[model samples]
Every structure is written in C-alpha cells, then in structure tokens.
Target: MDRSRVTVVIVVLAAALALPFYAGPFWMGLATQIIIFGLLALSVDLLLGHTGLFSLCHASFFAVAAYTTAILQVRYGTPTVFAAPAGVLAGTLLALVFGIAVRTRGVYFILITIALGFIVWGVAYRWSSFTGGDNGVTNVPFPSIGPLAVTSHLQYYYLVLAIVMLCALGYRMLVSSPFGLGLRGIKASESRMRSLGYRTALHLYVAFVLSGALASLAGVLYVYYNRFVNPVTGSFQISVEVALMAIVGGSGTIIGPFIGSGVLLGLRNWVSSFFELHAAVMGVVFIATVLWAPDGLVGLARRLRKRRTGIRKDPA
Candidate 1:
C-alpha cells in the first residue's frame, strides 16, 4: 500500500474504534449491520470487481456458512470458536465445490453460479427440520473471542468493526501481492496470462474460496449480532442487496463499500421505519446510482480528487 492508502486505513480504523462511545444505540445497531454488509460487498468485490468474474450466486456460499454456524452452535452444542471456523469451512467448501464447475471465467460462469445458488437456497428454505424453514435459527449465542465478551449490540459493533477492518486490510494485501497481480493480469487477458505461464484457473479458484471464506465470516458475525439466523438471511433478494451495496457504494477499494453501505443502509432503515413502499424508494436510489454513478460511491470520490487536482475530464 502507498502512503495515501495507509493514511486512509488509519483514519478509518481510528473512527471505527471511537464510534461506540459517541453513537447512540439506534445508530450503533445500524452501524453494525452496515459493517457486516460492507464486508460482504468487499468479498464480492474481490472476485467480481477485481478478478472480473461476474458472480451472482454468492448467496449460496453466504447462506451455507451462516446456517452451518447456526446448526453447530444451536443444535450440536459447539463452542463459538469452533462455530466461526466451521462456518468459514462450510462456505469455503461450497465455493470450492461450485467453483470447480462454474470457474469457466465469464458469463457462463455466472449462470453456473446462479444454478448452484438456487439449489442451495431450495435446501435452506425447504429443509424444515435443520434450517427451521422460514423461521431459521433464533437466539444465536453471543460470540466470546478468548477473554473478550461480545454480547451488547454496541460492544459487538466494535468487534465487528475490528474484524472487518482486519479483513479489508488482508484483502488489500492479497490484491497487492504477486498472486493478486496475477489475477489482474488474467482479467486483462487470460490467454496472454496463460501463455505467460500463469495458472489463471488456479488463481481464480483461490480467489473464489477466499471470497467465500470472507463472506462466511460476515455471515457468522451477522448471526451473532442479530441473535438470529433465518433462511431469508441467505435469500436471493439479500444477495441482490449485497451486490447492490457493493456496486452502488464502490467495490475493490477498502472504504468505498463502507461508505456505500453506510448511506444506503441508513436510508433503507429510515425508509422501512415509516413507509409501506420501502423497496420503491430504495429502487429509486439504486436506479439513480446506476445512472449517475456507475462506478459507485468510490468512483465519485475519485472524480472529486481529480477535480481538486485540476485534471479536466468528463465523468460520463
């Protein structure tokens, strides 16, 4: 990372750490969800935005991790430490399994993922005994990492923020590493990268698993925070929302999704509280974001930076 990126991360970490002391319960709860979704968006960014893979079926990977943790903790009496990793493992395996077939590396790849996603979703919603069908797994235990107790929503918010910040940093490092650079080269020209001796397929599989793992981590945190894990948590619509948050907020950058999730989630909560047509309002914002800011909130910030530096260029 360069100096500016370092500066940005430092500032963000500082702010996240400080939020609990300043923000009220309502905002704290909202911020917690925003952080979770932001991590999900960033995972989508890793495979889709950075690697140029158009994946829409990530909900399968997401739901599997979540439900796995729910089953382990709620039914089998697994500890939180085991539950988190078990969830991650479940998600990673799902990614690896589906990825082997769908790693075709383009639009076909997306279709394959969608097919897998539908299948998993069906199992989640239809398997009433294990998943509780629509009710899901309620009252998920609060996570206690070693000595730290993460029970309160506000306390849990900081824990999530810390995890998200750390994961984002790790993601940035992975993208900057040689393996990461190889993925970018593959995206630019897979044929050329293959000719250059890069194992493009293997790189994509690794990225896919990593993305799945990160999304699963977010799923575990989501369950812990809400004290609930429902089949709807892994629903297709929620998958769309995650994609929208990533695309609308900006992906592949550390802060863009956070900014996007923050604004969009805040608006959604506010709108849902008052109106029957909450989706209609959100749809308007989504359409506006796509039309006016295709590159996401981060893209808009980049434009502002360029303008401040006196560079003349058309946004469109």
Candidate 2:
C-alpha cells in the first residue's frame, strides 16, 4: 500500500480503538453491526468483483447459520462452541448445494439466486413450527467458552473488532495469493483462462462456497450480537442491500465494504429518526453513487488525487 493509505489506516485504527471511550452504547452497537454486515458485503464481492459473478442470495447462508445457532442453543441447550460451528456447517452445506447455480451466468444466474433466496425466506416465514415464522428464534445468549465470556456489549465490541481485523488481514492475503489471481484472470476473460487449461467452473464453484462460508461466519457473529434470528435476516432485501454496500464501498478493496457499511448504516440511523421515507433516501444515495462514483468511494478518492496531481504538474 501507499504511504497515504497506510497513514489513513493508522488513523482509522486509532479512532476505532478510542471509540468506546467516547461513544455511547448505541454507537458501539451500530459499530458492531457495521463490521458484521461489512463482512457480508465483502463475501459478496469475492464473486462480484473478483470473478465477475453477481450473487443475490448470500443472505440465505447468513440466515441459515443464524437460525441454526439460535435453534440449537435455545431448543436443544447446545453450548456456544458446538452451536456456532454447527451454524457455520449448516450454512456451508446449503452453499454446497446452491453452488450448482454457478453453472449459470448473467441474468440467469441472478434470477436463480433470487429464486434460491426467496425459497429460504419462504421457509423461514412460513415454517412456523421449526423457524418460529416471523418471530424467529430469540433469547440467544452472548457467546462464551469454558473460561472466556462476554458480559456486556462493550466487551463484545472489542471482541468483534479483533475478529474483523483478523479477517481483513486474512482477506488481504487471500486476494494477494495465486488463487485470487486466478479468479481475477477468470473475471478478465474466462475463455482465455480456459484456453490456458484452467477449469473455470470448478474455480468459480469453490469461490462461491468460500464466499458463502464467509457470509455464514458473519451470520454467526450477528446472531450472537443481535441475540435473535428472523426471516428478515434472510430476506431478499438484505441480499440486495449488502450487494449495494459492496458496490458503494469499492468492492475489490479490503476496507471498502466496511466504509460503505458505516456510511449506509449511519445514514439510515440518522435519517430514519425524522424521515418516514428513509428507504427512498437510501435509493437516492445509491443512484448518486452509481452516477458520480461508478467505482465507488475509494475510486472517487483516487480520481480526485490524480486530477490534483495533474493540475500541479501543468503550467499555472
């Protein structure tokens, strides 16, 4: 990374580390949410930005994982260690089945994902006995091990921060790895990649599964934080919103999704306080981002810097 970016990262980290001391409980909760959904948006970008596949059903995996953890803990009295992994497993298993959609592309792929997402939402909304219908599974306790445990939201905030930081680092390494380069190659030209003997289908399928796993992990974090799982958590709207988050944040970059998440969530919280049409406000923001910042906020920043540099070099 460049010096400017490194400086910006250091400043951001310092601010995050100091947030608990200055911000209230509500702000802490919101920050946690931004981190969680940022992970979800990042997962979507694994396919959208890297391999040029747009998936609209990531919320299915998120919901499945959340519901699995909730049900196991609430009904069966399972411990956090077992329930969390089970949730991840359940969602990953679903992803393995849904990976079949990787066979399709373009509009067909989008439609298939939409249908798949709706199926999960339908099951969650209608299957009252198993899923608790709209109410979902509730009373999920904060995650704890044999000795380590979270007693408050502030403590959880630090835990979430640590985990998200770790994920961001790992994700950086993944994107810099050879497999990540292969995904980019496929994105540039699948035919050319295939000509070079790359099994494009298998590559995309594996990415899809890995992306789903990441979404599942986000869901586990969310369920523990929110202490509930609802059909809305798995709804089509959520999938759309997270996709928009990735696009608005600069999908290919590690920090972009989190920045987008913070912007969108913070805007919603502030706007919804007085505006009844907050959803419309969000739509307008998306339209503006698409029109003026096609590559998203990070790209916009780079463009402005380049323009300034060009101006400085010219005779004036």
Candidate 3:
C-alpha cells in the first residue's frame, strides 16, 4: 500500500484495538455488530459493486449458515470445528444452487433473489419442529476448541476482529488479482467480456457463490455472537439493510461498508432511545445519502480531499 493508505489503516486499527478499552459494554457490543454487518455488506458488494449484479438473497445464505451452526451446536452437541464449517458449507451450497439466478440480469435477478430469500425465510418461520420456530435456538455456548475458547463478549470481539481483518486482507488480494479484474470487466460490459473469450456467465456465477460464502461467514459470526437463530436472521429486510449499508457506506471500497454499518447501527441505537420513529430516521438518512452523497461517505471524503489538494496547489 501507499504511505497515505498505510497511515489511514494504522489509525483505523489503533482505534478498533483501543475501542473496547475505552467504551462501555453497550458501545463495545455495537462495535461488534458493525463489524459483523460490515462483512455482510462487503459480501453483497462483491456482486453489486464489483460485478454489477445486485443480489437481494444474501441473507438466505447468511441465515442458512447461522441456522446450520446453531442447530448443530445446540441440538446435536457438535463441536465448533464441525459446526462452523458446516455452516459455511451449507451457505455456500445454497449459493451454488442460487447461482443459477445469474443467467438473468437487472431487475429479474433482483426479483428472483427476493423470491429465493423468502423461501428460506418461510422455511425457517413455518418449519418450527426442525428450525425451532418462533422461539428459535437459544443458549448457544461460546465457541470452544479444546484448549482455546471464547468465554466473554470481549474475547469474542477480538476473535471477530481477527477473522474480519484476515478476510479484508484476503479480499484486498482478490480484488487486485486477475480474476478480480475479470469480474470488473464483466461488470463493465458482458457483451465485451464475452467477445474477449471470457465466460461471463461462469464468472458471475463464481462470484455469486464466493459472495454467498462470505455472507455465510458473516452469519456464522453473528449467530455465535447473538447466541440464537431465527427467521428474522434470513428475512428480506436484512438483505435490504445490508445492501443499504454497502451503498450508504460507499460501494466498491473495502472500508466503506464497515463505516456505513457503524453509521447506521450507531444512529439507530442512539435515535431509537428517544424517538419512536427511528425507522423513519433511518429512512431519512438513506434518502439523504442517496441525494447528497450518491457515491457514499468514502467517496465524498475522497472528493473533499481532492478539492483541498487542488486548492493547495493553486497559484493564488
């Protein structure tokens, strides 16, 4: 990375590392949530931002993975090792099936994903016997691997941070790799990419699956942190919210989703305490973001910095 990016990263890391020490339990919990949702938003962006495919069913993969891990750990006495991977695998498998949606583009793809998401949500809601409907699964123990275990929320936060950081690094590498470039090319023009001998459908399908796997990973983190699984976890609203988080935070940028998560979650927590219309407040924020900062906060910041630089270089 360049010097400026390295510096900004160091600063952000320092703040993340120091937050728990300075903040109270509530704030710490909120921070953890932002990180988790950020990962989900990032996954959505893999399709929305990089590949120009807007998927609305990511919460299905997320919920499936979460439910899989929760069911295994709570009902069957499965170890975290087995349970977690099973969760990711289940979600990825769902993604593979859902990958067929990529054959259609634009609004059709969005509608299909919405339908697929509802299927998972309906199953979770109606199939109470297997999914623990309404009450859902509860009292999920913190993950443990023989000698190593997360005994408290703080430790879990650190674990999540480590995992998210590693994922971010890997994502950075992926976006810079040849395959990542190919996705971008497809995003720009499927016809052009096809002319260049790239199997655009295959490319989009692979990206969709990879995106689902990442969303599934986020779900695993969320289930462990929340200690439960429910239909709400896979609801269409969650898919919309996370997608909004990506757009509000600045799609196509690594740090943007996390920042967007922080803004939305923090605002909700603060506003809901005093205002019954907190959902309305969130709506206003989204509207404002769309109107004034279409590219997102990160993009706006970059614009401001460029403007300042230009002013500094001016003869006057």
Candidate 4:
C-alpha cells in the first residue's frame, strides 16, 4: 500500500473499533453490512478491473457459499470451522468449472456468464428442501474458530474486518506476482498473450476461482453476522451493488473498493436518515458516475494530481 493509503486504512480501522461505543444497533449493523458487501465488491473489481473480463455471475458463487454454510449449520449441524471452508470451497469449485467454459473472447462469454448467474439464482429460489425456498435459510449460526465465537453484532463486525483484511492482502500479493503480470498482459493484448501460448482460459479459471471464493466468503459472513440469509442475497441487487462499488472506488486497485465502499455506504446511510428516495439517489449517482467520472473517485483524484503537477507529456 502507498503511504496515503496506509494512513487511511489506519484511520478507518481506528474508527471501526470505536463505532460500537457511539453508534446505535441500527448504524452498527449497517456498518457491518457495508464492510461485508465492500469485501465482496473488491472481489468484483479483482476480475472486472484487473483482468478486464466481465463476469456478471459473481453472486452465483456468493449465494452458493451462503446456502452451503446455512445448510451445514442449520440442517447438518456442522461446526463453524467446517462450514466456512465448505462455503469457500463450493464457490471455488463453481468458479473453476464455469470460468473455463466462459473464457471465450468477445461478448459471448459475458452472455454465457449472465445466463449461468440466473440459473444459480433460480436454483436457490426453487430448491425449497435445501435452501428453504424464498425465505432462504435463517438462524445461520455464528462461526467459532478455536473456541472464539462471533455471536454478537460487535463480534461479527471484527470478524468481518479480519477476513476482509486477509482477502485484501491475498489479492495484493496475487496482483504483484508474475501471474498478475500475465493478466495485465492479457488485458493489454489477448492476441499477443495467445501468441506467447499463455493459456488465457486456464489463467482466467484460476482468477475466477479465487475471486468467487472471496465473494462467497463475504456471503457466508453476511449470513452468519445477520443470522439470516435471504434470496435477495443471491439477487441481481447484490451483484449490481458490488459492481457499482468497484467502479466507483477505482477498480484494478485494492484500495479502490475500500474507499468506494466507505463513500457509498456513508452516503446511503446519511440519505436514509432524511429522504425516502434512496434508490433514486443511487441511480442518479450511478449514472452521473458513469457519465462524468468513469474512472471513479480515485481515477479523478489521479487526474487532478497530474494536472496540478503538470507531469511532462510523453514525447511523440
């Protein structure tokens, strides 16, 4: 992380730690949801921003993980340790399998992925025996790792922070590795990468698996934290929110989602206090962002800095 980002994260964490004392249950709960969703949004950015692949079915893995965790705990009586990994594993396996087939060039892959996401959502909605149908699985237990159980809202918030940090760190390492370099290569020129025999499909499969796993982890955490998992968690709403956060925060960079999440979350919260027109506000914000600030907030900041310092233009 850069100096500015490091300082920002420090300040954010400090603020999070103090939230419980000042905020009421509603606000604290909202904060937890924002952080969890933010982590999932970061995963979306990992693929859409960095790899330049539009995988729209991200919520598929996320929902699958939630169902698996809910079933394990509510139906089969599995322990937290086992349930969490199972959720992640379910997501990874799906990503690996789907990524391979959907790694086609052009818009074909995007369509296929969108079709698959709906398929997953339909299953979650129809499968009443396992998923509890439209009601989703409720009373999903809080996980206990090494005898430390997260049973309350405050405890769950901290647990989410720890998990999000790990995901962020892991993503950072991956982006800094040779494989990440290959992704940037593909993003820059897929034909050139294919000429070099880079097996773009396989690389994408791996990226999808990692990305899906991260999203699923967030889903599982969301269910556990709230003790309720709904079908809407698998709905397009979740996917749209994640995509928006990534775009708004400045994708391809980990810090972007974190920053974007905070802004979006804070804005939503502040608006909910005064107006009943929250969705309209979000829609306007989203449209304005795409039209005027396509690079998102961080992108805008960088442009301003360059203009102010008058960074020398490249020699023609």
Q: List the residue pairs that clash in candidate 3.
A: none
Per candidate, the number of residue pairs that clash is 0, 0, 0, 0
Which lDDT tens digits does candidate 3 get at residues 38-128? 9999999999999999899999999999999999999999999999999999999999999999999999999999999999999999999
Q: Looking at model 1, which ten-residue stretch has the lowest summed lDDT?
A: 307-316
CA lDDT of 65 in candidate 1? 85
lDDT of 3: 0.94
Off by over 4 Å in 3: none
TM-score of each: 0.92, 0.98, 0.98, 0.91
Could you give the candidate ranking by TM-score, starting with the highest? 2, 3, 1, 4
Local distance difference test scores for all models = 0.81, 0.93, 0.94, 0.82
Q: Kindly report which residue pairs in candidate 1 clash with one another.
A: none
Model 4 CA deviation exceeding 4 Å by range: 311-316
Clashes of 2: 0
- lDDT by residue for model 2 over 1-316, one digit each (tens)? 9999999899989999999999999999999999999999999999998998999999999999999999998999999989999999999999999999999998999999999999999999999999999899999999998799898999988888898889888888888898899999999999999999999999999999999999999999999999999999999989988998888888788888888898899999999999999999998987898788878888888889999999999998
Residue 83 alpha-carbon offset, candidate 1, angstroms: 1.6
Clashing pairs in 2: none
> Cα RMSD (Å) between model 1 and the true structure?
2.9
